[model samples]
Target: MLTKEFDKPLQILDQDGQVVGPLPPNLAPDRLLEWYRMMWLTRFLSNKLVALQRQGRATTWIPSNGQEATAVGLATPLLEQDWLTASPREMGGYLQKGVSPAAVAYFCRGYPPPPELVGKDARCLPFTIVIGTQTLHSVGLAMAAKMRNENSVVVGTCGDGATSEGDFSEALNFAGVYHAPLVMVVVNNGWAISVPSHKQYAAKHLAMRGIGFGLPARLVDGNDILAVHAVMEEAVANARAGGGPTLVECVTHRQAAHSTSDDPTRYCPPENLALWETRDPLKRFRRFLYDGGYLDEKADKALTLEIEAYMNEEVQRAYDYPAPAPESFFDKVYAEPTPRLARQREEVRQETGAKR
Candidate 1:
């Protein structure tokens, strides 16, 4: 039942970082720097987190490493009040959306995620570790926007593997039927754990899935930050104008393992890694910056130092902050603790007393 109007994918930039079409006048030098800064900040945090995991400082870790473009580009076009629901690998989007460095570090360290993550107080949403479950959350948020007649749109993000989940399909169906103001962005990194993308789904392209649900869809080379920003701008503008939902599938590569516990060597070859390295999102963006005279060798060096210092500060802050007390678990689980939870809390208290 979907319209076939969107035949060719939308893109504003080529793989070499040149714009395929006109750059939006509004995104002139000053505004473009904002996007670059966000991406740099996220990349800095991602590298630090990987080090933290390796050093055993972090218990839970999911690094966005090479996928910086997809997150930052999509987030740049969103309003400050719009909602964002993301998978674990999308800490970059939170950074781009203005989540504080300390809060992100705390959450990734498993030391009580920030409150802003769960509430509308901040545009960011707490990540759903259960894969594609947040698709329904996005649908629900969009549905709420519709009921309230608000201009707010909900942008949900997921990995390629998430598309394999039933919740993803159901969310799209419901959102499409109601013409909800939602944008589903799939960061298809071509690998879902040890399984290659081909093994995970039979579809030729993830973007095509939107057609079945009656939604507008497009594919983009995720490494091209300019293209990502442009497409997201168009998509977000459409949704806010009450044009309903759009599905964007960004074809990028995962430069790291599924998690700290995963090893890509089990399935990926050395040449495959090398191929993606040449297409590193950061390098591509840097090329664009250099070619446009937006950055010089001195500026690049200074920026690198700045990012390193910032990340070191975040690491220190995370370590200095105290971990949440055992009671925090009890408090977060329910508004009013049930009798069973109350009893369990008492038991834990008793056990601690006995040990002391």
Candidate 2:
């Protein structure tokens, strides 16, 4: 149920990097550089994480190649006090929230990864493996904030595929009823694994789903960082002002496989991937900066080198952390081991000699 006026996604910059709308909010002289840096770091982090998976250092990893704008823009506007429930591919959010690239790389190496503490006091949750579960967690955090009379707003992010989950619906319903200070960002990347978005729902945008739950829904060009940042700023402000939850649908495309285990070439069309390539978020933003004379060739090349060296250090640091012990799960599940847990621990010890 999208109104005719809202049918089209909002755009602040065209694919060629020309401004197509008013200037995005928070446009300080250095803000553009900061935004581009975060996006670049995210892409590099993704490549490194995916490489780890392929190198047998990690089992699988999510990539955020095409959705850089959606991840960074939405996360950039958030304050340190605010909470963010992360989606698997929002590596930009993790980096922006003060979680080190090394910590992130290390997290991927652990089987099943760590939960919640992945970001610690940074207020960023670990990358969620269960699709829409973070939505509920966000609402709960918002409610707790309200109860404590704290002004912290909570942001929960998810993919279009997660909008179909019952937990998402429930989260929306509860947030609406309580007027929780929350922002819900749904990135419609056109495919849920091999399933095309056309088969997911009849609604023109996933934001429409929030409308039914009493949330204000907005659609933005996910590939355009300006548009994504502007819309996110507005939504976050609204929620912080006690205006209730707002849902934003970021229209983007997943340019690569869903994960290291996925092969999009088998099910996704080449034409579609090629089309999105022309709309790469980082490319468009970089072009805009160059056109505006905000970024010179020297600065651009320097930043590229800086990011490469920075990420290399991060990857090396990630390697410094030892892998989890095989029997760590049993010993760390609780302070005192129960009889059943002891038995399980003994069984694992007997089988693998996992001593520590």
Candidate 3:
């Protein structure tokens, strides 16, 4: 019912910081400030990662520049016992779920994250780089929770491009059939690499796809922190109450290149980028806080400086950490190395003068 009425991206706060729709209930001023800080922190970390990549201290950094609110909003509401399976670009979710900044930096450097940073007991999985595969992982985890009578939900996130993958469809069908406690979040950031949404699917909104699977679906303004948090809170609550999975399409823009390896100038026009700039999530939320008298210029400057110092310490620590041994890759492939693989490993060790 709500999904049908608000099929377009739902927005409570307009870009100018005025309420255009009814605000979500019980969102106190303190909670709003917390959400703002989370968004700001996510953006700050993303920007710093981009800089680290450009400086050659990090590798394959995926920019979550314009999607911080989507990441933080969807994740912040989840209970600590709940699990999250997210795409590589969902750094805000990872951080909110207790993944440390140093671990994120380690991830950017292509190194294995430390145990604590990898969410060993935090119920967060490593960032899923294989796109829609995490959808199935989320379904399986939720199914397991249901079997164990655990009151936890699995929140799976993927890009809109992933919706086209067979894995996404299969996971949705299974989750629907089993009535699993899961929340599937599709971040529709306009472009899936070089392909735009128009080329990705024929549906007016990706949320419609969940209708056939008998799941409640809604589209939320990914750029609006309050609206995103409100929608996701409802979705998570429903799943926890045994109402089955909910598909949420977060409509936002990809304000940066797909990754450090991408050249957006080849496909993304200047006009398109210029337009989304006006709807920038951080700016919109900051304006909202300012207008409400929750945040002032002095506080904003102080917060920025604090976040900068925190990131500087974490980034330097990550840089100083030792790189993983190249030979360890060979060790983990099998219980017992095959003769040919053993010979190859020895050859590499000999070539690199690496000790066992």
Candidate 4:
């Protein structure tokens, strides 16, 4: 029987990889391998990104080292028509949403993103590097959907530290009061750069903030892919059915520090390292697959080789990408540049002694 706790937060698998309850009813056995592949691909992609940053191919990168399950699982329930607003660590979500591997890797380069990823027909928004702005964008999208009588639900993801921002609160409050069909997913990976959660919020649980907005909210085991998917699927359903906003707090770990520039050892203790390792999502999920007879040593070895080959191809493609043209910056600013911006653009060109 499913634990009552599992109903509210809904964890499908325990740390030891034992099924805590029945699998998601709609999920087919044939599809489980696909989800596992996406999760593994996320890990492989993240490893490549870190290497790219180290080799100076990309300017900055926030490694989603421990965040694959949280991103990939929650993304599984999203229909192609549903909108998704994501923070920077959304490569996993993008991949699930049909973003190509080459497109994902090339975007991080100091160049225009490949046409496949950022084309006019793509559903995803450009990644928001600013902390909490995507919350407002998500709220706006939900509001527009409501106006259009569109039944699609929208999801916005942010870091745990983003909750401290006023924009995050305002977005939730507005979303609740308006009963906007949106899901606010907070991936609490335990640190915002040098600051830990203890220093960031006084509340015991981040999901409790949804109460203030008079919306349904709950926390979940972020590392458990099945658990995160089950809960987020329900949350998405509720939103699409016009039950209004839901706040989902996903408790996961960063495993690595904040980004390429960060050094977690400066703040976190070695014991903290040992603790999270025991709860490693990849290890835990692998065991779940093994116990269920869905995976074996042969499958694992072949999958590793497959992913490694893909990563190597992506790294080479990223290396060959051309630098963005100087004029490309001015192109995305607006439909038509304002007079001040036009003047500033010319001024910058003149100052840099560049061709018109």
The number of the candidate with the highest lDDT is 3
TM-score of each: 0.92, 0.94, 0.94, 0.91
Task: Name the better of 1 and 2 by lDDT.
Answer: 2
At residue 175, what lDDT does model 4 achieve? 95
Least well predicted 10-residue stretch by lDDT in candidate 4: 1-10
Give, for candidate 2, the lowest lDDT window spanning 10 residues: 111-120
Q: What would the TM-score be for candidate 2 when compared with the true structure?
A: 0.94
lDDT of 4 by residue, 122-218 (tens): 4667788899999999999999999999878888888889999999999999998898989889988888888889999998888778878887887
Per-residue lDDT tens digits for candidate 1, residues 1-356, read: 12333444455666566667667557687676667777788878877777888888776677787788898887878887688999768777777777777777777667556554333355767778898999999999999999999889889988889999999999999989999999899998888888789888887789989989989887877877887887788888899989999999988888888788888888898888887677677777777788888888798889788877886786677677666655556767889999999898888777765655
Off by over 4 Å in 4: 1-9, 117-122, 343-356
Q: Report the C-alpha displacement of residue 275, candidate 2, in angstroms.
A: 1.7
Q: Candidate 2 has which clashing residue pairs, if any? A: none
lDDT of each: 0.80, 0.84, 0.85, 0.80
Q: Model 1, which residues run further than 4 Å from truth?
A: 1-11, 114-120, 349-356
Cα shift from native, residue 83, model 2 (Å):
0.4
Which of the two, 2 or 3, has more lDDT? Answer: 3
